[model samples]
Target: MKNRTKELLREGKRVLGTWGMLGDPTTIELAGIAGLDFVLVDMEHTARDLPTIEHMARAADVVGLTLMVRVPDNDPKTILRVLETGVQGIVVPQLETGEDAARAVAAMRYPLNGDRGVCSITRASRYGALRPKFAEYVESADRELLLVGLIETAAGVENIDDILAAGVEVAFIGRRDLSGSLGVHGAAEHPMVLEAQERVLKAVAAHGRAWAGLVPYRKPGEEEWITHDVPFAVYRNDISLLLEAYQNGVRMLGRESASAHGQGGQR
Candidate 1:
């Protein structure tokens, strides 16, 4: 499997993606159809289990979408389970130290780059069909996996340099959680939160690493982040978009119907 997302990043292109937090393969497929470069299947904030994640990964593969997963934690089993499903990479949450980052990366790769368990029977290996070329596959996968480290906690930000050195390809600022860490719950736009985010961005840039985050769709400040050197951005989550679209559609149709009825009464 090829990691198109990593290829885009290597080309110095901004890769746009969306969140597949609804635990539905359909949403992941839709992101692919919409021409998104990737979709992050979230296991951190959702109830999605291994089977559901595997299904989403397969759907993404079928639709030619680059699939990455946000694992719930740095547990070796959790990371292995997600990667074995054939996703292109993983976003490890709440990573606070260099050791944490290193462990996460190790769990993503085989013994060549790291100590990830070897199993050629996985979908990642084309279900053992690629066993003949197993060595080559391991090396390619180790190089191509887009391991992203999330800097959402105070400790993570403080140890940002160490985390960067631990071989993560991207440093994603989780502003919502960072806000909580900064003592302001859910205040992602608060000054402290923005300042903390800037700190993380500066650290990433100084380390010569790429950065990513979720952008507010209707907000006017997206240009600021782009200018600030955030090359990867997730537009929104499937659940949030679905909710907004459904609510807006209902409201608009209701208004139009009411206006039409009033005009008919005038007749």
Candidate 2:
């Protein structure tokens, strides 16, 4: 399948996406319906398993959304298992060195480009139906698959240059873990955290790579958070979105009902 997210990046367009933490295909489908570029199924901090990821991929396919997954770690076997489910890419978390980045990339592709296990019967190749020529599929998958190296640890920031130079298409500045790592502890807007993020993004831009992170919808300074140089951006996650919407709706209705009763409007 054509990875529309990669195509958008190639066109120098902003690729907005969200996390599918609920492990529900409907969230993946909703992300597409909501005009997102992709759905990053969060296996790193959620209960989303391989089968759930595969179902999300199927839902993404139906809606023409690019499906990517965040693996729990930098393990090749974990990445390989995620790729076999037909995801467009792998977001390997806790990158600390160039070798970590390269190893993650190698696990996403086949020989020459990398050493991914061969299996045409997997959903990634459409179970051998869509990709009739195995060789052609291998080449295309290698070229089209996206590899994002997550920079959360202090060591990752120190080795930013080498990490990006290791062929990471996108360097994600995970400010939550980053802040915690920096002893800021959830203070994403702290000066130290902000500086670290800037350093990482600057490194990515210098290496001719892209930077990624989550941006709140319609928040003040949102525009400042996104830039032409960084094409990969996520807009919150499925669980949070649902929580916000439902909470707002309930609060609004509850306030209105309370006001009506206070005004003695009820029969």
Candidate 3:
């Protein structure tokens, strides 16, 4: 199976994604079939546990959608356990320095790269079914595992260079958190927030690493981020989409009913 997320980035293409915060495999499968390049399993703000994550991963795999998890934090055990669920990548939030980035990468690697306690018999290794050739599997995983560092604060933006040097494949700017960090809470498009984001994007590109971020779902004429070389984008979330669809339908129905009532009275 191809790591569609990284593959698109490597090709200099924008990869579209959606957030799977509902802990439902059905939503994940729907996203995959809808042609999303990837789904971000949001463990950070959700109640999803190991079983739920594994199910989501399986659904993503079956439909050819690349799955990545935003781990709760940089905790070693949490990182290792999530990776073992066979997700192709991890998004480590709150990356404030080079050391933070390094620590996250270490949790994803073996002793030579970092101290990740090894267990050949896990979902990541196909439960040891690929043994003997396990060395190759490990090497392939090392090369393919994407490390996405979330730059959510002013300090993280300032330390972008160090974060990049510490082996992050992609630097994702968390606009909401960053706006708060800039003291313009919720104003992701505030001048100060945009400037800080620009700085981080520039630094990430200068170091030959990729950058990712969120954009409002189909915000009119908002293609500048891609033009600026952000390859990964989370367009929206399942819950938001669901709510929007229902609300729009209700509004349309109300308008139709009012129009019918007015027309009948006139007749």
Candidate 4:
């Protein structure tokens, strides 16, 4: 399958995706069919566990979507377990320092450079059966897999420079949690939050790395749209988008009903 996320990032286009907190395999398959660049299987906030995540990853792969899992923390065991499920990428949350980011990279790579245990029969290795020219497959897997470090806390912001220097390919800003950490909870539009975002963009840009973030609004402001020089943008989650569309439709129908009743009375 093509790694659409990596392709978009390389082409410098804005890759769009949604959060998959609802760990249902059918929901993931539906999102893939909807033509999203990727879907983040949120393990941190959702009730999803390893087995369910593995199934969801395979479902996404079947539909040509790049599956990325947001690991709960920078735990090596969690990283190894998810990667073995054949996910294209891993997003490590609460990354605060260069060392933390490096550790994530280590967990993704094999030993001699990292501590990941070798397993030739895992789904990532195509169940240990070679398709002729197996070495090529291993090389491609190493090159295609991504390591994304999520910067969400005040301390993470303080150490942003070091994190980028650690060679993480993508630095994603967790806007909701970031705002709270900056003492401006739910104020993503606050000047403080905006400035923090700017700093993050600058640091990542300085190192020639990719960046991504979430935008609350459907129609983003000019700065929000451009800031971070964001190559990939995760616009919203499935549940939130569904709720918003449903509420809007209901409100519009009510307005139309009131207008029609008034016109009838006048006639």
Off by over 4 Å in 1: 212-227, 255-267
Output the better candidate (1/2) by lDDT. 1
Residue lDDT tens for model 4, 22-137: 87888788888888888888999888898898898889878988889999989999999999898999999989998998889889877555777777788888887855656666
What ranking of all candidate models by TM-score puts the best one first?
3, 1, 2, 4
Candidate numbers, best lDDT first, in rank order: 3, 1, 2, 4
- When 2 and 3 are scored with TM-score, the better candidate is 3
Across residues 53-145, which tens digit of lDDT does each residue of candidate 1 receive? 889888998888899999888988888878888889899999999999999988988886788989999888889999999999998899888
The C-alpha local distance difference test score for the whole of candidate 2 amounts to 0.82
Cα lDDT tens digits, model 3, 97-164, are 99999999899887688777788899988998988887788777887888888999999999999998
Per-residue alpha-carbon lDDT of candidate 2 for residues 89-149, written as tens digits (9 for 90 to 100): 8888999999988898889889988989988888888887855688888888998899988
Please list all clashing residue pairs in model 2, or write none if there are none.
Answer: 110-114
Model 3 lowest lDDT segment of ten: 258-267
Where does candidate 4 clash, by residue pair? none
RMSD in Å for candidate 2, one decimal? 5.5
Error of 4 at 49 (Å): 1.5
Off by over 4 Å in 3: 216-227, 255-267
Scored against the true structure, residue 215 in model 1 reaches a CA lDDT of: 56
